[model samples]
Target chain A: MLKDITLGQYYRADSVIHRLDPRTKIVGTLVYMISLFLFNNLICYVFAAVFLTFVVGLSKIPPKFMFRGMRSVLFLLVFTVIYNIFLSTGTVIVKFWVFTITYEGIQQAVCMLIRLFLLIVGSSLMTLTTTPNQLTDGLESLFKPLKIFKVPVHEMAMMMSIALRFIPILMEETDRIMKAQIARGADLENRNIFIRVKSLIPILVPLFVSAFRRAGDLALAMEARCYHGGEGRTRMKAMSFSAGDIVAWVILAGYIFAVVFLGVTFKTFPEFLVLEMKAGLEYLIPTLSAR
Target chain B: MDIEVRNLTYEYDSGTPQAVRAVDDVSLTIPGGQFVGIVGHTGSGKSTLVQLIDGLLKPTAGSVYLDGEDIASRKFDRKHMRSLIGIVFQYPEYQLFETTILKDVCFGPLNMGLKQEEAVNAATDALLRLGIPRESFGASPFEISGGQKRRVAIAGVLAMNPKILILDEPTAGLDPGGREEVLGLLKSLNESGLTIILVSHSMEDVAKYVDRILVMNEGKIFMDGNGKEVFSHVEQLEEIGLAAPEVAYLMKAVHDAGIPVATNITTAEEACGEILRALKN
Candidate 1:
């Protein structure tokens, strides 16, 4: 029944993004997110939206799936929008009850919402396209320079991989425990907040007990197989910088260069681009909706 | 405690790309106080059928009638129905979380609104029914042997005092001796007038105990009959990824080798007796 949770948001499909080297995707996502924060006005925001949509389309992951990750942070987005809309000062659009909505407030809210939406979608695409194992591998390679500072980077990656693996197992365990209690007539639904929290004790106790047991078993199994620390460990599949990865880096660099250039151009010629974007949107939105 | 299922079907993820017709158009009657066995290959809708029977899952279509009353109706007392028809899932032993064996067994009865003393009494009675020793009543369920923990788990359900007992693989993971012990208790319980629905993958266990057998295949009841009648159709059962009891196959092999013996034997005891008689002749 709890299967509706599409968390970890891994969209499974055959696409260029899915096949891209995890390092490239990771760095690409970082550049994408950094540019999202760098964009200052409507013109750049529109370009950013276009860029994100293009990447999402190329990834072949459903738009629904990419936005599904946004569902978890929807409240934060709304709160930020409301906070910025009501609290910020500019040419007032309306005034009511110690609150004022300004034209600037509307612009900030829209820009913030778009940024939040793009942030979630961009990150979700990376996770959805790259498997957890690949993510761990990418992180390990990216943090390799820290190994000189005595960081157990390999060990950290292994821990992450194990944690990622246990997520599904723990989810199944939780479902079973919840059902077992429910079958015994433990009412999980229709409880007040306090009682609901208390009702979870039955689930928590068994879950903790099982988790400990599993961890202990895993440790023993690892020891029995003569596993030590990650000091001299070697990977079965070593990471390589492929042609696809180079293409991804080049595209990402171009995107950052465009955003930086756009930011400078916006600083120098704000009125020209802003007026043109306003007119384009005013023309485009109605036609899009009519279609 | 008669259960009549009428054209029941359950679909998981209905209308999705991965939609599954788990139990499709299945209808059957479980007579009062009878030991019936449900057998099928994994994912053959055996578990789905039992879960539907207990109202744990609502059917996508059709109804389940208990004593001619439709249990699936919106107004049915779901809690009372669950109390009346207890379901012990596979590996129920893993569900034990109470501090003591007695406490663990009492959970169900207490949940049904019994007083503390009454719940304990019900739990004790159930434990005794399964031959669990009273000396171990106060012991932690975690401290018990694997087989004992399973008994304690079953006792927890039996404490509810259900008229119909539904077990999915009650003897699963038990040693041969533990399996026989569990089956013996089920037999006695059936004799004492509890309608028992046993879902199992072990055809030998089913043949040894259950009077009637239901074979599920591709989300439907492919075969329904007494042990003899159902086991006789070996080919049909095999086609659906099931086989008759080894004893029945032994008898069939002997019969096919030109020996004059009954081919429908479903128990080792009966098959041995027939083979001995054939040897003597």
Candidate 2:
């Protein structure tokens, strides 16, 4: 059951999406996400959906494998759908004793639902195609300006990569420890919520101890290898952008422009999209989008 | 209790590209109150086989009858299987979390719903049976030597009074003296009527101690026999990245040198007796 978690999982395949530079993929994902919120009509959604599906096909990752991650976010998806269903206001399409369903409310719900789904899937595409090391390298390079302010960017990036490397190792360790406790008759399953939490103390206490021990051993191993806070470290595999990445960026820029253009021309764009864009941008930047 | 495995098969991460048949169509039996040892090279399914017997893993397509109860069946009581068959995994001491050795040892029996005093008595009895001193009972398990901590971990499982005990490389990290101490403890316990399943890579230890041996290779039972009989087929054993016991090799060397000694002697004492008898003749 622990193996079912697909967080930060990368699927390795030979495809245009996987072969593109990590920076290009990261930037392209950002542009694609921004384009998702710049639309409010069925035509714009159709264009977005087609673009996404095309990219998914190009990536060569199985659709079933890609969407398997949505299981974890099902709760959030349902919550947002319900929230938009009753709260969004407009012409009342149906009226019950205490509840009213509006045409605009249904439209808003569909838009919000599409946006949320696209947002998760779009970002997951980046992680699925790129390795954690490549992702870290891209992020560190993007955040290189922070080094000018002496923010220790290199050390932070190194720590993150090491943490990612050990996640599977720690997960396997937890599985073993849980099995050991179970052989001792520790009931991790079949308990009430309160008792279950209490029962986890046996599992958690040892897990914490072993984790600390592993951390200590890792620190010692690093010191033995003369690791000194990422100073003067050079990557063996250097990062460089190629022509394929340029083509990808060009397509993304065109896609963003088309979404913005079609979004504005859709009837009801003035009333519905203005409010949605405002809400979306406010989420991106609290201060800048307050207006 | 007896364990009867019939056509047992297990696969890790089945249906994916990474799927592995760690144990395949393997059938065997561990009769009650027997000292049995399983020998295999790395990835030979030795570890996976033991876990399957105790219900830690369910077989994909087979049955495990633990004393006439189908342990793989849906109605089988999993918790009862756990208590019936205790497993001390490799480096078992790493799971120790209690402050004192006594509490750590009592953890298993307490988990089985024994009263506090009864659990304490059972734990103390287990520690005594393993020859752990009373003075060390109150000490922290972390404060002891690596060997002592391993014994404490084993004692924790023994406190449950399991009908069958399966240990996976119980002496893996210990020194030679500690290894003998641990093995000696296991030998005496086996003699005193606790069914023991010893899993190890050390052919020397298994040859010297266990009366019955099961050799595994690539997820299948390659050979099974008495220690003397299994160790006699040195070449076949070596073909699969395993070797006969050191004594058998020693006797073989003497025989090749025309000393006319039997090369099938697996234990040191048996080799010594055969060598002495040959010299007298």
Candidate 3:
């Protein structure tokens, strides 16, 4: 059951996005995240959504899986929408005894929800197409100039890649330890909250012990093989930007331009415009509540 | 506790492109109270097959029957099944993390819902059976010797009072003396009516202790018989990357050298008796 965890899981596939330089994908993802918060209008959101859909298609990752990823954060999305709807101050659309739903509140809630969903989907696409090794290589290359400031870029990338590689191995160890505990009659299921928390001790303790043991063994093995802090080291597969990477950059630039143009031209949505016009008519007509 | 596997098949990473068929259309009935040894090269499905018997794995196809009840059935409680069949995994010392040897050994019984006092008593009895000192019960397990730690880990499983004990390479990485100690404990457990299924690459250990041997190759059982019968087919066994028991090989050489000694020898003592008889003739 633990195997279903797909956080930062890379699925290998031969596609345009998968073929793009890892450096390009990494930089593009950063740019996309920055641009998400920059655009606020409905037209810009539409443009962003379309651009994400096109990229998702090119990556050959099923839309269903992307939606599945979003499902994990669905609870937070609903909570945000509900909180904004009742708590924000604006012209009331619906009035109860003490609670009122406002026009601006609904607009902000929808915009925020869409923004969060797109953020997760866009970043997930980057991870899904790029291997962990390639991603780290990209990070090292991108941050190589920082070495002038003595930032230890190579060491950081090496550590991150090693950590990423061991995640699955550690997860597998955790599963084995849990099974051993279960065999011993530790009931992890159908217990009270306190008991359940206590039950995890058996699994976690062994997991940590084994993790440390593996780390020590790995260090010795690396040292025995003469590994020394990534200095004067060369890679077998060097990173290079291809034609596909350039095309990807061009498309990303076009997406940013479209978002910027739509953000400037579209001041308000038609639905909000209609709501304001209706409120103006309400002011002209006398209401029984006003009496 | 007899384990009856029927047409069992398992696939790793099922539904993914990287899926692999680890176990395929395999079925075997391991009789109750028999010390069965499973031998296979790495990745030949020995580990996967044993895990199936204890319900650590559910077969993609077919089922496992323990004491004639389908273990995969919804009516069957897997946790209770696991308690009935104790599996001491390879490098079991890695599973040790308790503050005291007693607490670590008592883990199984406590999980079985035994009272604290009852669990402690059971752990003590198990430790005594495994030849661990009673005074060492309160000591940290990490401070113990490697062999003692392994015994303590096995005692943790023995504390559950399981009927069938499945050990995966119990003697792996141990010195000869340590290997003998662990194997001797298993031999005593078998004498006390506990069924043992030992998975190992050491043909010598299996020849000395196991009642029956099951040889696996490429995810299928290549041979299943008593030690003598399995070892007698030295050529076939060697073809699958397994060698006959040393006694068996020596006897085969004696027979090939024109001696009328029996080739069905598996243990050194049996081979010695055969050689004496041959000399008398």
Q: Which candidate is the best by DockQ?
A: 2
What value does the lDDT take at residue B232 in candidate 3?
80
Q: Whole-model Cα lDDT per candidate?
A: 0.85, 0.87, 0.85
- Estimate, for each residue in A175-203, the C-alpha lDDT of model 2 and write its tens digit: 88888988999888865888788778777
- DockQ ranking, best first: 2, 3, 1
Q: Write the per-residue lDDT of candidate 2 for residues B110-133, one digit (tens) a residue.
A: 888899999999999999877799
Measured with C-alpha atoms, the lDDT of residue B9 in candidate 1 is 90
Off by over 4 Å in 2: A264-268, A278-291
**Where does the lowest 10-residue lDDT sum fall in candidate 2 chain B?**
B10-19
**What is the lDDT, from 0 to 100, of the residue B181 in candidate 2?**
90
Residue A235's C-alpha lDDT in candidate 1?
Answer: 77
DockQ computed for model 1 against the true two-chain complex using alpha carbons: 0.57
Which residues of candidate 3, in runs, are more than 4 Å off?
Answer: A62-68, A88-92, A97-99, A102-104, A265-291, B72-82, B217-222, B229-243, B246-265, B268-281
Estimate the TM-score for candidate 1.
0.91
> Higher-TM-score candidate among 1 and 2?
2
User: On DockQ, who's better, 2 or 3?
Assistant: 2
Number of the top candidate by lDDT?
A: 2
The positional error of residue A220 in candidate 2, measured at the CA in angstroms, is 1.0
Summarize candidate 3's per-residue lDDT along B1-281 as a digit string, tens digits: 77899999988888767678888888999877889999988888898888887887778898889989998788988777767899998888888889999999988988787899999999999999889998899999888998899999999999999999999999998999989888988888899999999999999999999999999887788899998889888889888888988888788889989999999888899889999999899
lDDT of 1 by residue, B1-281 (tens): 89999999999867545579999898888889999999999999998898888877778999999999898778888788868998898888878888999998988888888999999899999999888998989999898899998998899888899999999999989999999999999999899999999999899999999999998888988888899999999998888888988988888888889999989889988888999999899
Off by over 4 Å in 1: A268-291
Q: In every candidate, how many clashes are there?
A: 0, 0, 1
Query: Where is model 1 chain A poorest over a 10-residue stretch in terms of lDDT?
Result: A271-280
Worst 10 residues of 1 chain B by lDDT: B10-19
